[model samples]
Target: MSQSKSLLANIGVQVVIAMIIGTAVGAFMGHSAAMFAPLGAIFINLIKMLVIPLVAVALISGAAGLGNSTNAGKVGFSTLAYFALTSALAVALALIMGEIFKPGVGIDVSSVEGMFSGEYASKGELPSFWATVTGMIPTNVFASLTNANILQILVFCLFFGLALSKQPKKNREPILQGVNTIVDAMVWMINCVMKIAPIGVFGLMAEAVGTFGFSALMVVFKLFLVFIAAILVFGFVIYPLLVQLFTKTSAKSFLVAMKKPQAVALSTASSMATLPVTMNTVENELGVRNATASFVLPLGATINMSGNAIYYGLVAVFFAQLFNIDLSMGAYVAIILTSTLGAVGQAGVPGPSFLVVAVLLAAGIPIEGLPLLFALDRIFDMIRTALNITGDAACAVIIDNIAIEASDLTESEVKQS
Candidate 1:
């Protein structure tokens, strides 16, 4: 009885309860629920406030601590490989699940037609592939930070951090220490923001439900169901199995340890907000090495987003169905590739799924449907962010184990010599 009471007191539980209440109230009150919008907006803004500085500091600190260029290169290569492979698998799973479920089938397109506007329609044009690549390198660092351009910020941080890492310890120690202090302070801010999550979640839910109404929700209800199903299967089954296979880690223990961070991701719907918790859980509870956790988790927070990739694939198909656009096998392949690449490019950006606009354009889906899709983003964002951070933790564990095995082999060779 005592344990159950404690469990109910957890913030995650409170957020869930709040969501239910908000949904009920929104349904009952209708448009009047818009009054709650300010609360949710404030909460989201608070989370956004931390993104720029937090990402910059975390990336800089992680890269600067790499000891030397060789170790940094090896860790970088491993991290990118893990991220790409997992993201591709996630996109594949989404495409398969989407085909099986056909989430967008039977939706009355006329109901959502009014929701589409000229603003969103014009915003869907994607830059050419080469332009997208070059765009990541910022012309001005301050401009990137001010504009919250994540890819550009990531590029600048990589260069700056690598340079700092190469400097003498006596010269760089103070700078690294300063960056660490900033990270700690940003984490403190996240915790403080989290205390209000139940309220924030309630307001956000009420606004979405009230504004869209149950009828609007039902229009895309199947898509929502498919997304939830995918998240559950990926989070519970696939992730744990991978951990067990790669690192011989106990799946049950890993998931249990991950619960808190997962909850934070779900509530905030920001992987960046969940980074500190993910790092702490990986290092302290999961016993992943600090070196591996530090380098991998921060980079993962920025670049590893299997969940976003999955979302891209699923939603692209959903929109394709809604618009009666038939995608060939070749188009599906393009979606998987584009989504995987977009996930990497858009990492650390809040509303990471917004990057899916590019995927839709590439796949020849009408951009007008984007507004309707955005309506349901908040709910899906929560789950996808949870999956993302979980993948990050799993990658950390796998990489850490490989590093350990390699070190042991090297020591044995030395003894033989």
Candidate 2:
């Protein structure tokens, strides 16, 4: 009885079980599997319901903790720079993998050519750099909170947290305590939502598999195969190597602790939805301090989309090959730059990403064939979202180590003096 209870208690085990059952149901139920979609939707909504408040209070607390320290600026810079560098690396890796694998070389697109559409053409237009910067700063934090404008919310929270930290101890202490209390409560609510995670995972899997069977993926089966390979290489190899090299946390421990959040990310396909689980794992299991986890993880979820970068880069190469277009050096440059930078601002949600359109267009690749992949986007999203959250944890781990080292150095210097 205790053993069974423990199995039931393990979120990873439960989610895996749920995914297997869901696949079976999807295979059996066919189109009727969509009935389970609301279960997944409700689960995602519940998580989203708590995300804004959690990010707000948590960032404030994290920033407040670091506000007086000189490491605050270093932490923020390192987080942003690390996200960009890793995303760029992800795109470069995808392009290399896509070129070597040539997943699109022998495909018969004429057969599914009817599925193509120009509907996504307009979405390819990315905002100007200045516009994107302006967009991040919220004029009204309340409105941004109401609308769930994540980028803006992230900016305000970080700024507010820093400002709050600068206040007098009497003023900051009670308020920081209150904010920290709210963060703890938010985590409690997140844990509550996770209790039903298995059911939600089952529903999401059932609907996705039922609606789009494994057969639909056969058209792009090679793409799927190569994409999975890229995910493994980056998630298993690159991120783990970085963790091992930079931090005291062993690669095995990092990967093992990440399994739960990774599974949640796979089932939900939303980094934002999985943020709570990521935080729980990074801090409690991985031993990252709250201040660092709070600051890095939230920002990473909001902006760090290395997973999307891989998807975008690989999809561009796939289509360019499918159409027999010889990409110029400039085209390759455009693809790498676009995928790397464009992924930075992507919303960490479950929807089919439109950023592929931008990458394709920037590289002068055809966009009409995009709809073919859209059908299987859910499967791809699940795979990549798991990678995305893993990258987030990885950044948290590395940055946490850097922060610790800097603190140690500062203390050592003071002692010497």
Candidate 3:
């Protein structure tokens, strides 16, 4: 009884069971399974309610704590570099896979003619670089907070935290202590919300399967298989290799430790929603310092979307192939660069992936067939989300080791002197 209870208590095991049952229900009940959607909505709403405050408090803690370290600048640079480079690598690999497999080669667009639409055409235009950059700055912090404008909130809190660190300890500790207290309260609420994760997973999976059904999937099943293959390569092969190369954490152990957060990411389909669980698992199970986990994971959840990179690259190639368009060398370069930047810009939220449109437009691919994918986006979103959080954890592991190595090198040099 005790052993069985433990298994049932494990969020990962419970989520897996819920997913299986939910898929079965959706397959059986078809559209009727959408009724279960309220469970997912309620759970997601509860998580969203906690997430804004959590991101606000946790990021402040991370920035302030790291600000006190001698290597704060190094950590910041390395974290951003890792996110950019890995995202580039992910998209490049996706392009290679798409080229080799050619999933869209024999696809018959005529059968799905009714589904195609040019309505999404206007959305394909990329926002100008200056506009995107300027948008990150906040005019009013309170208004940004109310609207859940994450980037602006991040900028303000990071600035506020770093500025706070420059103050005398007498002035800083009380506010820091109070913010830490709020973070603790937020974590407590996350734990409470997670207790119902199984129900949410069931509802979400049921609704996704029932709404999209398997018939539409036949048109894109090859794309699905290839996408999963690419995700597996990135998740298992690339991430594990990087961890073993840079950190003391064994590849197997890192993968094992990440199972809980990956499950949560899969069910919730939002990195922001999965942040608390990722922070907990990375710090406690994976033995990263709280400050490093706090710093890297949140930053990663916001910008490091390697999974989205892969999806965008593959979607561009899929559409190019579907139209029999012989993409130029310039088009490949455009696909890679646009996909990389687009992936980084993606908000850490659950929804249909619209970033693929920007990548397609960059390469001059048609946007009509995109509507076919919108229906299946939820399925793709769930799988890629699990991969996304895995990348976030991998960064925490590797960055923490970099800090450790830097400190040890400093100590050694001092002793030698």
Candidate 4:
């Protein structure tokens, strides 16, 4: 009895309970559950408060501490290659699933009046691809931070950290220490916020269920199932195979080790929230080197978004189908490219799925379908976040293995010399 009671005290367990309670309350109370909206907002706000600082500090510190020029370049190039390849694969899988399932084929939008709230209807056209890429370079660093432009912040940090890496060790130590201190403080802050996560999740879920109700969910149910199926395939089948091929880690062990972090990710619906656990598990449990884990996972959290890539591709196709928009071959190519890049820059939080708006605009699909997507965002957020962090850990393992092989080769060469 005592053991069972203690187990129930765990935050992950509590969060699951909270989700159930929130869903029940929303179902029964309906729109009145929107009263809990503020609570959810406060929780999301707390997590958001930590995002910019945490991402900036983690990236700068990781890059600066990444060792010699050759190693840093190697790791950087390798990580980017892995991210791009996986993202492309993810988008391809989504497109395949979307075509096969045809989630929106039979839906009649004519009778579905006012299903969307028009919250995300675009006021202006989306920027061109070149324009979007150029916009990643921030004109005003402080303004970018204030606006929480993730790609802009990432671009600035990459340059800043590269510069810092070129400085003498004695000159860089103080700055690196300061940045590490900030990272520690941010992680500590996240831990503090996590104490209230159950309540926050409860409120968020309640608000979503209450305001949108089951009807909104039903409208997108087919797309939701298709999305979930894609995630399961990626997480269970694809990730495990990659891990085994790259690192010799068994799928069962990796999955078991990830259970805690995955649960937290599912509950909080934030990859950033799961970072600390991912780092710990990858290093201590999974045997990934600290250096590799530190550099790869933080960057992965910001940019390596397989789950987002899949979601974006499917959502774009779904909207296109619903509106009977016949996409040109050029549009399909654009969706693949834009969705992959968009996932690379997406924030690792609940609502960053909104980035799909940019993809929809680029594909010439109307943004009027956004509200329907938004209504079911939370449900999908949970699953995708779990996949995002899982991919991060897998990347860490693969990189760590490569680093070790390189070290061994260097050692053998030195001995032979």
The numbered model that scores best in lDDT is 2
Q: Tens digit of lDDT per residue, candidate 1, span 56-157?
A: 887787777664433456667777898999899999999999989998888888878988765655555556789988988999999999988877888788
**True-structure RMSD, every candidate:** 3.0, 1.1, 1.2, 3.1
Ranking by lDDT: 2, 3, 4, 1
Model 4 per-residue lDDT tens digits across residues 163-267: 898889899989888988887788788878878888997997788778878886688889999999999999888988898888878888988788777876876
Better of 1 and 2 by lDDT: 2
| Model 2 whole-model lDDT (C-alpha atoms) | 0.92
Better of 1 and 2 by TM-score: 2
lDDT of 2 by residue, 29-121 (tens): 999999999998898889889988998888888888989787888998999899999999999999999999999999887898899998888
In model 1, state the lDDT of residue 310: 82
- Assess candidate 3 and give its lDDT: 0.90
lDDT (CA) per prediction: 0.81, 0.92, 0.90, 0.81
Per-candidate clashes come to: 0, 0, 0, 0
Candidate 3 on 127-238: residue-level lDDT in tens? 7899888988999999999998888888898999898888999999999999989989999999999999999989988988888889878888898899999999999999
Instruction: Give candidate 1's root-mean-square deviation (CA, Å).
Output: 3.0
